[model samples]
Target: MKEKIIEALKRIEQEFEVKICFAVEAGSRAWGTSSPDSDYDVRFIYVHKTDWYLSIDQKRDVIELPINNQLDLNGWDLRKALQLFKKSNPSLMEWLHSSIVYFQAFSLDGKMRELEDQIFQPRASLFHYLNMAKGNYRNCLQTAAINSKRYLNVIRPILACMWIERHNRFPPNEVQPLIEALIMEGEVKRELLTLIERKVTRDDHGFEVDFPIIHDFIEKEIRHLEEYANSLRGPSRDFTATLNELFRQVLEEVWSQS
Candidate 1:
């Protein structure tokens, strides 16, 4: 798997004319609870030579590869990442924390890791998670009566909301860690876990539909948690200017060399 990913990275990098700083397994696989069929969510950051950005014309800031079997490789242009970093996007924050890194060069990724907390935006992140939950619930749960994968889809963001509310932080990259570290011995914890596990199993087995009780519970929980997250304004989003300076320094070093 490693060799395959490396070869794919090489092909894409050469074809795209960008340097890949790191390619990581960012989704369920990196989170330590991947099923046998989980997709390899390849997340990476890359940079182009000085000419790529020396223009008033719009630049392509993202790289999206064709979806492959059990593997999906994609990347963000470094400057694009930096601009989003300024806004404190949650997905970018999680990308920096991904557990499986397949490539690294010149300590560029290391710099991004160091600037995580300094750039995490609480209010934006909360709204990000909330909006994601709302979209997934509406789209997935609505058609879940004919399919079940959608249940797991809606559940994750709701749990993320719970994590943010309690931890007063941007939440972890992995869903399981947030659950284990944040939720303790309580009815909320047990019920939510059971729902997740059951849904996962059914999805793996290719179940046809969901139990009404389970579906209803998930809906109720999503609503309850959305309300909970909306009410809380935590100190999770404030960016430290010092950290931002550090990020700029890192970008300068990389861009200067390129």
Candidate 2:
């Protein structure tokens, strides 16, 4: 599968005339809770030639391949990625911290890590995760019998919100580390472990009885995080200048070598 992904990336670069800087697994697989039939959610950041950005017209800044049952491959252009990074987009931040790496070239990861502390917006990230938890819970887990896989969607974001409130930074992308750091050795933690075990061992296709303990935990966290997120002040700095400079540096570094 790794080889197939690498070959596909190479084909994408040649066919589209871009250079892929970084790529990683994004969804349940990277979070360590993927089941046997889980698809590969391959996300990447790529750069086109310098001339491609020198136009007045708005060109597409994303590359998306047709999704199949086994692989979902797509990428963001470098400029688009940097713009999102400046805004501290939680999805982009998670991409940077993904545990599974498919490809990395140049210094994109190092450069982003150096600026992470300065650019991270805790308030924005908190609201993002909080909203995710709320929406997933309301949509997927409000019944007696629920899709068991939906628990991770709610629990992971809630844990991320907890991590942000406690540490004031972006949370880890994987759920295990977040669990270890935030949840104590109690019924909630035990229940979460059991859910994760089931998630990885079998395909999630049917509805099952919901875990009341997990439901209670999710409800309490959502209410608490809403209050905490509202208390945080707005972002303190404008990162446009810093990100602009970095964007130019990457264009120079990537194209100059070719």
Q: Number of the top candidate by lDDT?
A: 2
> How many backbone clashes does every candidate have?
2, 0
Per-residue lDDT tens digits of candidate 1, residues 94-165? 777777878887676677667665665566677787788778777864663534345555656666677766
Task: Report lDDT (Cα) of residue 251, candidate 1.
Answer: 58
Candidate 1 at residue 86, lDDT?
69
Global lDDT of each candidate: 0.69, 0.88
| Cα-lDDT of candidate 1 | 0.69
lDDT of 2: 0.88
- Name every residue pair that clashes in candidate 2: none
Query: lDDT by residue for model 2 over 1-258, one digit each (tens)?
Result: 999999999999999999999999998998988888899999999999988999999999999999865999989999999999988999999999998999999998789989999999999999898999999998774665455577888889999999989988888888877897899958888878767877888644563434688878888889899999999898788989988999999999999999
Q: Each model's TM-score?
A: 0.79, 0.95
Q: Report lDDT (Cα) of residue 135, candidate 2.
A: 91
The residue-level lDDT of candidate 2 at 84 comes to: 93
